[model samples]
Target: MGEVDIFKIMKEAEKRKKIKEKPILVKKVEIKEILPCLTTPGYIRFTAQADREIADVIPIIFLMFPPGKTNYSVKENTLTLRAFNRMITFFPNGKIAVTNTRDKQEAEEILQKIIDIINEAYRSYLKYGKPSKETIEAAAKLSWMDIYNSLPKTNCGECGYQTCSAFAVSLLQGETKLSKCKPLKGEYFKNLERLKQKIGEIMLNTLGWE
Candidate 1:
């Protein structure tokens, strides 16, 4: 099979496992207040919630303005926010979704915490706007082939792999450790650390990390 096929298989297996898992219950929630902002050409409103502990487990929710023009859909924990220019998909821990334009005011009054985060991200965007492609590419290129080649070519089982190529694939997927190569000790190990930092930067800047 091709490398892409292998990656697809791994991703499918992971998705299935995630799907089988149940989400924790979020209860006794209250929402209040709404602040308006723009998600793109369309405007958005901040909604707040009270009496819930859904933080950290889910993505922040926002109520889009001119509501029916944008749609928010949820399947299990995954939430997709669709707008004219952009589509954002995330898993939300809170029991909140963007309401249709007709219910805009009511939805805003009920989900207070959601309102807070939307406002924050909006303010950040106004100040910094979107991150540049050059910045993102710089982060992606942080890791070099030289560091990858320096790894022990042996497919030693000590790293819990039958082959070095397998380990390299894992590294690219953020699944395996460079130290597991065993032969890459000292300065070589340090270089691996640097490469990881770069990879992490890329993942963050590009929103590629899950």
Candidate 2:
């Protein structure tokens, strides 16, 4: 068979195996509504669904409320919800990072119902908050200089610049493009692209971006 046919057959075999596996079934719950928190930058929302139990021992179930603001938190379980102008944190689990927010009685009511629904499903684990400052700083230390050096140093000015070093500095400052390094075509270009993504993630998670 051709390479394409071989690949297709492999995919089909994988699908069959997945389908044969037993599925975990949990009780489902419905969410009536969620209230808004105005204190934070983003809105808070809640959902009622089948969630894992808190622990094998505990009978407590959980409902998840997520913050609309991406920069505020990263943990999926705990969230900072905004109610009007104030934001509240809630923790469904015992973890440090996990927290929940609810501003009004109506929101609290919705959260309780969501917790009930999740209890019907699988066991739940504690959630944690965002990474610590030290962890973020470590990630930033990885640096973008290596990728910068790999670029072509021709200084041909094809990318509308005077020198490669100048462009690199600009890239670091978020002023110029990595592609502006004319020599970074082919595999080197792709590698630089990957580096860019990694650097961006580090900057966003650790340094905090605008």
Candidate 3:
């Protein structure tokens, strides 16, 4: 049996306690308006307000959105994404709109979930420092065809896509892994290197971010 250090155990517990005690950036949100959701005929949209600005957290929350469903405008200081079966829009001043929910309670619950997302991103920022600035335009400029041409084009079905073109589409959507192509690790190794250069870090790291 290993000797346990009681002081070390107490220090670890204090560290976790301090983390839990950290104040949340978004304590609560108040629903300001409710309207029929234009995009989804049967759903409702609720606009809400937060206690503080959350613009800085957008980059960290990018992956929280469904693949291919996110758009961010640094110039406009806004982010829009479809996630959790809802369309959500965010602004720098803490204004938020969420569609596909009904009534105040439902709206608050959904916004609370958003707060959780924000808290998660905030924690990461505090722990790791700010994320590196990515070349969003580069990812935006990439076409599925560009990815398709760079692939082995074997249509091997090892990646679960029926055709190389389909896989390319999935890759562009950030829905599929480049390593899943299989042949890239073997016969098509050079093509893999070429793809890395063309696609840059987004594809190389399989983050699919822009």
lDDT scores in order? 0.43, 0.41, 0.73
| Candidates arranged by lDDT, highest first | 3, 1, 2
Q: Write the per-residue lDDT of candidate 1 for residues 8-117, one digit (tens) a residue.
A: 89999999987455332332444444434444334454333434443332222322221222232322434445432334333344444343322455444433434444
Model 3 lDDT tens row, 126-202? 76455454434344456777778778887889989999999988876668777788887888888767755554443
In lDDT terms, how accurate is model 1?
0.43
Which segments of model 2 are wrong by more than 4 Å? 1-139, 142-144, 190-210
How far residue 87's Cα lies from its native spot in candidate 1, in Å, is 11
- Return the TM-score for each candidate structure: 0.29, 0.28, 0.69
**Model number with the top TM-score:** 3
Judging by lDDT, tell me the better candidate of 1 and 2.
1
> Which residue window of length 10 is worst by lDDT in model 3?
201-210
Worst lDDT run of 10 residues, candidate 2, spans 58-67
User: What order do you get sorting by TM-score, best first?
Assistant: 3, 1, 2
